[model samples]
Target chain A: MTFRAERRGTFRAERRGTFRAERRGAFRAEVRDQIAKWRRDGVFEPRSDSWLTGYDEDFSRRLGARGWIGLTWRGRGFADRFVLTEELLRAGAPVAAHWIADRQIGPAIARLGSAALKQALLPGIEAGDVRFCLGMSEPDAGSDLASVRTRAVRTDGGWLLDGQKVWSSHAHRATHAYVLARTSTGEHKHRGLTEFVLDMSAPGVTARQIPDMRGPGHFCEVFFDGAFVPDSAVLGSVGDGWGQVTGQLAFERGGPERVLSTYPLLALTLAAAGPADAGRVGELVARLTALRRLGKQVAARMDAGEAPIGAAATLKMLGNRFEVDVIEVARSVPGVPRAAIDDAVLAAPGFSLRGGTTEVLGVVIAREAMGAVG
Target chain B: MSMPDVEEAAVKVLGGAADMRDAARITAEQGWHLLGVPEPEGAGGTLADLTGVVRAVSAAGLSSPLPELHAPVVLSVRGQLIAPWGPAWENVNLAGEPYDIGDAPSSGAVLTRWRILHAARLVGGCQGAAARTAAYAATRVQFGRPIARFQAVSALVAEAHAQAVLAAAGLEAALADPEDDLVAVAALATASRAGTAVARVAHQVHGAIGVTQEMGLERLTRRLWAWRDLPGEAELEPLLGLLGEERAWDLGAGDE
Candidate 1:
C-alpha cells in the first residue's frame, strides 16, 4: 500500500462503535420511513410557491392520524418527538413548520394557556393541522430580544397588537404565530414581554418571506397592524411573557435536532467514496462517536423534563462548531470536490446562526454555568 | 467499575474475609489478580465488565458508582478472619479524600455511590497529553523547528503516554494484596499524579484546539478534573495510614 493508502487502511483499526445513527422510537421510525421515501421517491423539494403554503388540506389531516406532532406532553401518548425532530433534520425534511410548533408553540400553550384556551386550539396543533411561529427577535433586537417594542393595548374588546417581528421563520406559513408583546414597563428588560398566540389569518397581520444569503426564505418579517386578539389569545398570564419565553427558549435551545442536521448528507458523502478516504473516516468516527454520546446525554436530560439549560446551551454551541468543522474536514478529502454538487454545503451555511447564534449562546452558557449575570 | 468488580471478585477469589479491603492489598502487589491485567489466576476483563452491572446502572442514568466495592465489605463480618479460608487477603485504600457525601459514605450503599466519582476519573484518562501538544502545535514550527509536527503531535502524545502510565499504575495498585506495604499506596499516588497531570498537559499542548468545539480533548480533560475531585482523594492518606496500622496489627498477631 502507498503511504496514503496505509494511513487509510489503519484508520479505524483501533476504534469501535463509530456510527451515530439513532432508531430508538416509533416517532423516529416514522421519520426514518419518511426520509427513505423522500430519498427514493424523489419527494417534495422546497420551492418558492411551496415554502410558505400549507400542505394539501386532506393530506395534512391524513398525516395527523398517528399524532406525530406534540407527542410527549401530559395526557398525550408517550411518543416523544425530539428524536423525530432529529431524524427529520438529518433527512433534510422541510421541518420548518414542525420545528416552529414543537420548539415554541406547544410549550407556550401548555404552560400558560387558559383551560378554555387550551381546549379550543391545542388539538389542531397537536395533530399538525395548524402551525405556529415565534415572534421573538426584532430588527433592532437580535440578541437583546427582550428589547422588542410590540405593544398589546388592553381595550374593551381585547388586545390590539401593533408590533413588527423580524427573523420570524415560518411566520408566513403558520396558521397562528405565538408573539411576545410588552404590556408594561419593568425594571428588567425581560420583565414586561407577554407571550400570545396570534391568529395569523385574522385582520391586520401581514407576513412576507424575506430571502437571506445563507438559505433564503425560511425567515420572514411579520407585522401586526392593530391585529385584534381576544383576551383568550393571551398565553400564560399577562406580563408573564418574559418567564414564559425563557422557559420556551430553554426547550427550543436544547434538542437532538440541533446536532444532527447535516447527518444524511454526511452519509451520502461517505457512501459515494471508496477506501482511499480511510484516515478521514477514522477522524470523523472518533469525533462523531464522542459527539453522539454528548448528544445522547443532552437528549436524555431533555427527555426527563429537566431542561439542562446551561448544558444544553453548551451542546448547542459545541454542535454548531462541530458541524462547521465536519464541513471543513469533509470538503478537504481527496475524493470529494471543493464545492458541493447538489448544493448541500451552500444550502445550509447559516444553520450555525439560526435558533440562536453561537455568540448569544455563549452569554447564556456564561450566565447559567458561571453564575455571573446576577 | 474495576473497584467494585475487583472487590467482589477479590472476596470470591481469596474468600477468607468479607472486607476484601484487608485482603486486597496482597492481591495488589504480589501479583496481577485485578481484572484486565494478567495475573497468576489468568482472569482478565475491562473496567466496564468487572464493574459491569453497577457501572451499567450508572451509565443507564443510575447514581450509584460501584456497589461491588462495598459489597465485599458488607459481607465481611460474616466470615471470621481468625479461622482462615482459601487465602488470607488484606486491603488498604490509598484515596486522597473522604467521600464527603454530607452523610457518611461508609455503608455499602454510600461506597457504591462514591465509586461513580472514581470511575469518572477514567473518562479522559490522558487528556493532558492532547492539551500539552495543542499548546505548541498551533504556534510551533516544523522542519525549521517548533514541534507540533502533526495533528496528534508528539510532546502531547508523550505527556498523555505518561498520564496513561499513571492510570495503569493506579489501577494496578488498587488491586494489591493486604500485605501492608507502601507499593500499593505508591501505585495509587502514581496513578493519581499521572492521571491528573495527563489531562492538564494534554490541554497545554493542544492550545486552543484542545478546548475548542472541534477539540476532542475537552471532555476527557473535564472528566479527569471531575474524577480527581472525587471523594477518593481524601481516602488515600487514610488508606496509607491503615497500611501502617495493619502492619502493626499483623506484627502483633504474629507474636500471638
Candidate 2:
C-alpha cells in the first residue's frame, strides 16, 4: 500500500461560493510525508497490543523525539498536532495513553497557561512521560455538563478542590488530570464551573479504575478530597471555564477516531471476501468515501481555525451509523462461531450513544439544516 | 479471499445525544458515532434495526414525517430522493396488475414501495448466488486442481456480484425509502432471476457438491427462491386472475 502525499484543500468549504476539490500545495505534501513516517514508525499504534508498547521507555523516547506526542508548536504540545490526532484516531491507532493531554489539557494550557506553567508541563507531553486523564462528567451531571458540582474555592496561595468525577478515561495510571470544578455557588450554572490541573499523586486526589466490559480498565471515577491547586493551577479563568470546556468538546467530537475502531476487522473482511465480494465491497467503499469527503471538509474548516460545529455533529452522527453498521456486517459474515464476535458485539450497542448520541445530531440537522431558513 | 461467517457478532451498546424533538440534539448528547462507539457499553445493531426504528417513528403518527423524517433525516441528510410527492399519489396499476390501497395513487407513487421490496429480495438473491457459485467452484475438479481454479468457473462467481449489486441497491433503496411501490416488486422479480441464474450456473460447475448439505448451496438457493415471492404473490394472484377474465372488462365497458 502506498501513502499519498498529504493533500490539503482536498475538500472545499461549501461556504466558499464555489468550492472545488483541490490539492493543498507543498504544505500538504510535507504533512503527507510526516504522516507516512509516523504510520511507518507505528506512532499511531493500536494502544495495548502495539509493537511499541512492549519496550516501554524506549518507545516513549522515540515518540518524544519525533514530536508525535506534542505535535504542534515547539513549546505548545497540542497547537499543531490536532490534525495528527484526527488522522491517528481516524486511522484507528491506539491513543489511549495521551488521549487527554492531546485533546483536552494541551490546548487548554497553550491558550491559558502562564510562562511558568509551560516549562513544568510541556516536556512530559513531548516525551509521552505525562499521561493525563479527563475529569469532566459526574454522576449527577452526565451530558448536562454544567451540573458539575466538583468545587474549587479560593484559598491562600492555592484553591481547595473537592468533588467527584465519573467516566474519567485512563485515570488510574495517569500522571495528572485536568478537572472541571464548580467555582461559583449560584445557579449561573455554566458560568459557575472552573477548570483545574490536578496532580494525581497529590495526597488528597484519589482515582479508582473502572473495568470495561471486554477490555482492561480504560475509565475511572475520581474523588477529590481537599485537593489543593495553587493559583497557578487553574485552567482558563475561574468564570470562563465554560468557553474552555466547549473548546475542549469541539476537539473531543471533531475527528475520525469515532469511526475507525473496527478498521482491522474491515481490512480482514475485505481480504476474505476477495473477488466475489468486489461489488459488495464497492458499495462499502462508496460509503467510506463519502465519510472521508465529509470528514475532510470539517477538518479543513478546523485547519483554517473555524468551528464547523454543525458539520462536526453531522459527521459524528454519520460516523456512528457507519461504525455500527461495519460491526454488524462483520457479525453477519457466515461460519465464524459466535465466540468470534468479540468487541464488535460489545461496542455496537453503544454506537449511537457515543460522541453525542445520534439523536442530538438529528436535532442539529433539524434546527440547523431545516430551521436555519425558517 | 475466504468469506467471514454470517452469524457471528459481538454486541456494541451505543447511545446518542437524545432530543427526539430534534434528532441532532439526541445524536450529539448521546455521543452517536459508528466507530469507537462513544457509548459506555454493549455491541452493535444492524442498519435495518436503527433505520427501521426511524421509519416506525414516522408511521406511528406521533410526528409528521414532513418536518421530521422527510425534512431532516431524508431530504436534508439523505438528499432529495425522499422528498414528499405531495397529495396527488394514492394508488396504481402495472402490466395489467391493479394494486390499490383504495385511494388514487399514481403508478409512480405506488411503484416506489414495490421498488424497495423488490430490492430486498434481490439482495438475498445476490448472496445466495455468490454462495452457490463458490460452493460449485470449490468442489469440481479438472486437470488435477479443482475446477474453481479455472477462469470459466471463476467468471460465474464474478457475475454474481453484478447481479448482487443491483439487488443490494434495490433493497437498500426500498429500505431507505420505505414506500409501497411496484418498483420494489419489479426489483424482487429481477433479484429472483439473478439469484437463480447464479445458483444454476454454480450447480453446473460443482456437478454434485452444489446439492450437498455440507456444501450449503441448497441452503443459500432456498432463501433466494423464497424471497422472490414476498409481499403476497397470493394477493396478486386473485387480482391478476380476475383482471385476466374478460367478462368484467367487457361488462364495465358496456356500462360505460
Candidate 3:
C-alpha cells in the first residue's frame, strides 16, 4: 500500500509538472501574439532601453490587464515571469511605466509592507494604475548608497522626509517614490537607514526633469522639502533599509533587461548582416546564448528562494558589455538605420552605470570570487 | 558514479602527477580515456560522464592528449587526421604543448567530439586562470594594502571570473544538446572568446611576475592561448551564421 501510494503521488506530481509547463507555454504564446498584434496596429515601436526610456501607460495597462504584472505575488513563478519579461524585452516593448514597481517594489511591499500598505498599494500596482520611481541615489550617494543624506524624522502620523534624489528615472510621472532616508545616527553609515514609500503628489514634494545627452530623458531630480510618509508606508523595518535594499539588488540586476537592452538592434543587424558580418554576428549570438542561460539560472535560483546576488552581478557586468558590443556590431551592418544605431550608441554608456555601476558590481563580484577561493 | 564523483576521482588521480606523460599513464590506468566507450570492447559510460574528467585534466594545466584519445579519430581543421603514435613533423603549439600532424581519414563525428572537449578545456582553463588571479590579487599587497582593494584590480578579477562563468554556461548549453551542431559551434566560439579574455585579464592583474614560470599563472594562460585558437573563432563563424534570427533566439532561450 505504501509503495502504491508513493507511485501514485509521483504520477500526480509529473502530471502537475506537465500542466505547469503547458500553462507557461500557452502564456508565452499569448504574450507573443498580443505583442505581434500591437506591432501591426502601431501600438508601440521597438527601441533600445525601452525599460528605461520608453514609458507608455496604455501599453503598461494593457499588460496589467492581461495579468502580467506582480507575477510572483499573484502565485506565478519566476520562470513564468522570466518568459514574459524576456519576450517583452526581446520586442523592446515600452515597459517603463510599471517596470520598477512590477519588477522589485511590488514584491517587496507584498513581503514586508503593513497590511494597510498592501491594501492601499498592491491592487493599484497590479492594475498598473500606480507607478513607482526609485529614490535611492542622492546627489552625494551614487555607489555609496549607505551615505545617503536624505533625512526622515518622526512626525504626527508618520515621518517627515526632506532630501534631494538625483537620477530618479520617470519620477515626474511616477505616482509614488520609493525613498531611502537616514532615520538616526548609528555606529556605521550602513545603519540608521530606512525605506519609505511616499506619494509623489504629497505636499512639499517636487520633481524636475534632467535632460541627458540623449535629449530630454526620463531622468529627473526629485526634492522633498518635508513630504509626509505614513508609518504604514515604511518598507520592511525602520533602520533596516540597507539590508532590504541590498536584498533587492539581485532582482534588479538579474533580468532580461540587462542582457536584451539592444536586442531589437541586434535583430535588425542580423537581418542586414552580410557574409562579411557573419563572424561578428556569430560572436554576438554566442555571447547572447551564454548570457541568456545565465539569466535563466538567476531566475531559477530566485524561484528556489535563493538570493543569487553574485551571479546576478556577474550577469550584469558581462551583459552590459554584450549590450554595448551589439551596438558596435549594428553599426557595421549595412542596412540598419542610422538613427537606431545612434540611439544604441548613446544608450550604451548607461548600460554599465545604472542599477549599480560596473565598478561597484566588480567589487561585489570580486568579493564573491574571493569568498569562493577561501 | 555521478558526474561530480567522476570529477573528484579524476582530480585525485591527476592532482600530483609530475608531468603530462605521468598524468596520461595514471589516467589510462584508471580507464578514464575509455570512460564513455561502451563496454565489452571498452568500459561503459556516457558523454556527460567524460565531461568531469576532461575538465579536471585541462584545469590541472596538463596536456595529456585525453581529448584526442577519447575520439575515434583526431583531425585538424585542415581535414588531416592526427596519427596515434607519431607526427609527420615534430611540433609544439604556442603553449609548448604537442601538436600532432599526420595522414589519416578524417571524420566529422571525431571533429565535433574534439571541439566539445577542447571547448570544455578552454572553460576549465579560464576558471583555473581566474581563480589563481583572484587569489594573487587578494594577497599581493601594493602601497600598504592588497591590490584587490583597488577598484582597478578588482575589475580585472571580476572580468576574469565573469568570463569563466560565461564560458561555463556556454559549455553547459552545448553539453545539454551535444547533437545540435549550432549549439556546439556557438559553445566553441564562446569558449574561445572567453579563454582569450580571461587570459588577458588574468595577466593584467598578475603583473610582471605572472609571466614567470615561478608564478605559474602562465601554465593556464598559455594553454588558454593554445586551445582557444586550435580551431579558432573564425572557423565556427559560418556554422553560427547558419542560425537564423528566430533559431538563434531560440538557441539562447534554451526552451525545451
Candidate 4:
C-alpha cells in the first residue's frame, strides 16, 4: 500500500475515547459550520489575516452564544479551550473582539473579584455582552509595568483615576477597562498598586486610536482625568495588583494563539507550495506540532491551578520566534507573491513585542530558574 | 500492563541500571525483551508500552538489545526490509556493526525499525541531558551568582528543554500508529534534528565538564551521531517518494 493510504488507515483506526474524541470532533464541526456560515454571508475572509483585521463584536457574540467563550471558567479545561482556539486560528476567524477578555480578564475577575462584582459582570463577560481592554502599559512603561504612572487617589465614594494608558488594545470599543494604578507610594515599586475595572463610558474617560505598523489602529491610547471609580470596581485586593497582573500574564502568554498567529499564512503556503518547498515546509510543521503539544501541556498545567510564569515565558519566546520563521519560510517558497504574505510578515514584529518582549521574557525565565534553584 | 505503569516500572528498574552490562543482565533475568513481542509468543504489550521502556532506558543512560532483538523478528515477518531469515545465519549476526547483516542477507526493514527505536532513545537521552544541564546551570556559580541568573545560559538551557519536549511529543505521535512508515520517517527526522541541537547546547552549558568521559553524556551523544544515518536517505527514499511533494507537510496532521 502507498504511504498516504497507510497513514489514512492509521488515522481512521485511532480512537481517542468517547468524551474527548466526541468533544473535539463536535468543537471542530461547530467551528467549521461557523466558518461556512460566515463565508456564505461574506462576513469572514479565509484568506486574510483575521487576527489583525477581523475584530467583529457580532462575531464574538456569535461565538459566545454558542458557549465558546469563558471555557475555562465554565469548568471546561484549558485543553478543551485549546482545541477550540486551534481550529479558530487555523481557519483565520476574527476573534479579537473577545480574545483578551476570554483568555485572561474573565479568569482574573472570576478568581479575584467580589461576589457582588462577579454577579454583576461575570455573566455579561461569559455571554460576550461586554468586552474588556487591558489598561496596564503606559506611554513610558511598556515592559516596565511597575513603573506605570497612572495614579488612583482615594475619594469619599471611591478612587479617582488620573493618567494615561497607551497601547490599550481596543479600548475605544470595549465596554470596560482593567486599569492598574498606583494606590500609594512605597519603598518598592510593586507595592501599593491597585487594579480597577474602569467603565469606558465614564464621564472623564476618553480613548484615541494609535495607528500601528499595519493600517488599522486596533491599538488605542486611553486617557483618564479624574475618572471616578467606585470601591467595588477594584478587581482584586487593594495592594495586590502586581501579583494579579503577573497571574494574568500566565494566561495571556500561554495559548495556541501565541504560536499559531501566523498559521493562516502557513495554510496558504501549503496550498500553493511545490515539491521543492516540501523540506522547509515539513520542518516548520514539525516544530509547530511540537510547540502545539507543549502549549497543550502548559494549558493542562494552568487548568491544575498552577500559574507557571517561567514555562509560559519559554513557550511565548519559542512560539513567537517560530511565527517569524514560518513567515520567512513561506516568503521563500517560489512563485508565492510577497503581496500575498506581506500582511502576516508585517504583523510579525508584534508577535515578539506585544505580550512581553523577547528580552524581557528571557529575564523572566532566568529569574524563575534562579529562584527555583535557590 | 498499561503504558503509564510500564513507564513507571521502567523508571524504577532502569533508574539505576547505569551502563550497558547492567541493562543486559536486567533484561535477561526479567525477560524484558518479551514485552515488545506480541501475545502467545511473548508478553502482549502496546507499542506505547514499548516506547515507555525505550524512553526510560535511554534517560538512564543504559543500552538495551530489546529493540535490535525484537524489531528484526517483527520487521522480517512483515516482509519490510531484508527478506525473512535464511538458514545460514538465522539467529546470529556476524557483522561488526550492529545494523549490518551477518553472513545472511537481511532486509533494510530491520535497520529502519532499529533507527526509529534509536530516534526514540535519542529523545530519552535529551530528556536526561536537559534536566542535568538545567540543574548544573542553576547551581554552578559565576560572578558570585548562579549562571542560570544570566540570560545567555538560561535561554540556551530553556531552548534545549523545548527541543526535548518537541522530540518526545513528535515520537509519541509517530508511535500512536506504529504501522505508518511515513509517521516513523517524520518522527525520526525530527528526533535527529532535536538530538543534534540539544547535544550542542548541553555541552555549551556544561563547558569543560560535559566533554569528560566520566560525565556519561558521550554514551548517548556518540551513539546519536553514529546511528543518525543507520537507514539514512536511501532507506527513506521509498517512503518519501510515495509521500510525494505536497503530502509531506501534511504529516503533522497526525500530531493534531
DockQ rank order: 3, 4, 1, 2
Clashes of each: 58, 120, 0, 5
For residues B72-152, write the lDDT of model 3, one tens digit per residue: 454555455554323332667777765567666657767667677778888889888889989999999999999999989
- List the lowest-lDDT window of 10 residues for candidate 3 chain A: A1-10
Best by TM-score: 3
C-alpha RMSD values across all candidates = 18.5, 23.4, 5.1, 6.7
Model 3 bad stretches (over 4 Å): A1-27, B15-29, B33-46, B73-90, B102-110, B252-255
Off by over 4 Å in 2: A1-61, A72-92, A334-341, A349-351, B1-256
Compose the digit string of candidate 1's lDDT tens values, residues B217-241: 5535554554443322333333332
lDDT of 3 by residue, A1-374 (tens): 11111222112122123234457668788888989998999999999889998899999898889899999889987778888998898898999999999998998999999999999999999899899999999886667878888999999989999989999999999999999999997559999999999999999899999999967789999999999999999999999999999999999999889999999999888888888888889889888888988887898899889999999999999999899999988888889899888888888888998989988999999998888786
Cα displacement (angstroms), candidate 4, residue A18, comes to 10
Give the CAPRI class of candidate 3: acceptable
Ten contiguous residues with the weakest lDDT in model 4 chain B:
B92-101
- Over A12-88, each residue of candidate 2 has an lDDT whose tens digit, in order, gives 22123322223222333454476568679866543211111122444445556666765534542222353355444
Model 3 preserves the real interface contacts to a fraction of: 0.45
DockQ for every model comes to: 0.02, 0.02, 0.29, 0.20
Task: Specify the CAPRI tier of model 4.
Answer: incorrect
Q: List each model's interface RMSD.
A: 26.7, 24.7, 8.1, 10.6
Model 2's CAPRI class is incorrect
Q: TM-score per candidate, in order?
A: 0.58, 0.52, 0.91, 0.84
